[model samples]
Target: MLVSLTREKFEQIIPLIATGAQYAYYWGKWQDLLNRLLISVVAVVVILILDVVLGQGAQALILLLGVIAGLYWLWSPIYWASLRNNQYRRFPYSGFWRGRILEIFLTEDLIGEEETVNQRGDLVINEIRERRINLVIGDETGFEIELQAPLQRLYKAIAPGQIAELLVLSRQPNLAKIDKFTDAYIPSLNLWIGEYPYLQRDVFAEVSRQLGSDRSRANLNKNRVRKPPMK
Candidate 1:
């Protein structure tokens, strides 16, 4: 199921959108922009109020806090893009793979420890757990791997036995040596199940369509082979 994917092929298949559009999409819509702007404005106003009320003694500290907020608002987009570029750096060599989801189930997972105040006002650390869906996928060769993802709205539609697609990466150009893997794309559900969104949605869809056609043809050939000749 795994097919060789060179860097040239990867770049062609996984195209990145324009920087402006990508930033807007990843950073969110007008609501997010307003929230960030509002926080920066609030911090500046608070700093001014502190300077007037608390006098010059605390001006340095107050201004520093305001500057930090402003800086975060200004540099957030660049910081986000830097994080997004990680996929390119991590997977120098990769391959496309198609498989079938063999199993699907939910499992409770410990997320973190949260501090809560009890009725008596005693603070206690409590374990936070959430149910997450886990999927097991395999190829016709019997090579199976488990892919775990947080339950999202689209994931509810995914069932066992549906086709699953993913990009398998390797340190070397060897398909057998699977060094790492990108998130799994469930074409049937039009959903990607993973912690991070590695692939561009439009480009991923294009690649999936090509693979789907190939799969259809393969099935047709198999069916033809299975049919008995006329007596």
Candidate 2:
């Protein structure tokens, strides 16, 4: 069920899935920058307090620890930002690959938390949901690929055993973006259903309708089963 697509056609589909609102990109770079900045500020305050309490003898030790911590906090953000920028710039020039989806699953994670006080003076935990999709796809030649995508409604529309295409960056295969997907297989009908863009919102509604119809037909056939006359 693999459909080979030209680079031009693949680029056209890239925008549908390659959105800027990915959870990984946000947590990996932006949130990371803020976290490091906060840690560095706290470290500096601690070092100053230690210097005053321990006097000149411990000043050298305190300075050494502070320097190491400062370098660590300062380096991460710079490296991450540059790497992220380069990835985005190279996406348009990446190669494309197509495969049939063997399996798909969604995962939800609590990446961070916010604290709040309730009316009764109780502490509340506000958890952030980070959703992602894991997909296993295989090509005609039997090569299989495993991919994970950040939170997107498109993942819900896709079902197991559907044909899908992906855009693969030569150096960064893990960041491969989903390009398109076909409808699920109907067992009784023995057919592959409609094709839709990966980002289409109406796909879920259409899939629900098709599934409802199939369920009704299956129940009707089961009720039609005749029992033999028994003693």
Candidate 3:
């Protein structure tokens, strides 16, 4: 069954979801900071080498810049972490809901690739493929939610027309976070099938086990309906 929330319920849950989103936002920022720090370190090293070779007398200037960058690099994560902790303190409850994917699409965007040194000190060329995703989700009550997310793990796992469960911070409507796809009934096959390929075996096993029970056997035989297996 599709799990939904009313506006009152939605208001209550928004903060929970917002906390999750806030953390995710800060995490992305942290990553960007780390990348920038790495680049700054490399630049500092290059500048020092140039100073030594060219005798440019700019070593002090380069060193100062490096120190400032390093300080900011160390401070950024701590600042964001504290902020996240403070916000999450207000929304401590967690809950889940079931919804169906109504639509899914992506828009491609170019991102600058960063150069990194591996353990062996060799430069690794990384190409960034950034994409923005738009997902339209509908609950059993016909309430639709539209989300824009980075093309990341959860976004890649789900598709249009699939049923999914989301974990949200309780009392926070805006914080609906994708948990996983759920098995759905296939009227054509008279069987339950997983929305995701990796979950097929587990879903099948659970459903078969449920049908095997004497209590559920009769119900299974009568209507042959299946519910999404709990994780």
Highest lDDT, which number? 1
Per TM-score, the best of the predicted structures is: 1
Summed over model 1, clashes come to 0
Q: What local distance difference test score does each model get?
A: 0.75, 0.54, 0.51
lDDT of 3 by residue, 1-231 (tens): 333334343334333223333344444665687786786677667766766875657768767766765565555544565554435334434333446679877877656787999999999988887777766778777766565545555445566777544433444445454332323332223333221121123333433334336446666689977799999
How large an RMSD does model 3 have?
Answer: 14.2
lDDT of 1 by residue, 1-231 (tens): 888866876765444432453465457778777887887888788778877989878877877877886766666765675566555546678788889999998899998898999999999999989878889999999988888877767677888889899877777877677776667887777777865555566666777798778889998988885568889
In candidate 2, what residue range of length 10 has the lowest lDDT sum? 192-201
Could you tell which candidate, 1 or 2, scores higher by lDDT?
1
List all candidate RMSDs to the true structure.
6.8, 16.8, 14.2
Instruction: State every prediction's TM-score relative to the real structure.
Output: 0.68, 0.36, 0.36
Error of 1 at 110 (Å): 1.0
- Compute the lDDT for candidate 2: 0.54
Off by over 4 Å in 3: 1-31, 34-75, 92-94, 107-130, 152-157, 169-231
> lDDT of candidate 1?
0.75
Q: Count clashing residue pairs in model 3.
A: 11
Sort every candidate by lDDT, greatest first: 1, 2, 3
Which of candidates 2 and 3 is the stronger one according to lDDT? 2
Off by more than 4 A, model 2: 1-31, 53-64, 77-115, 139-145, 152-231
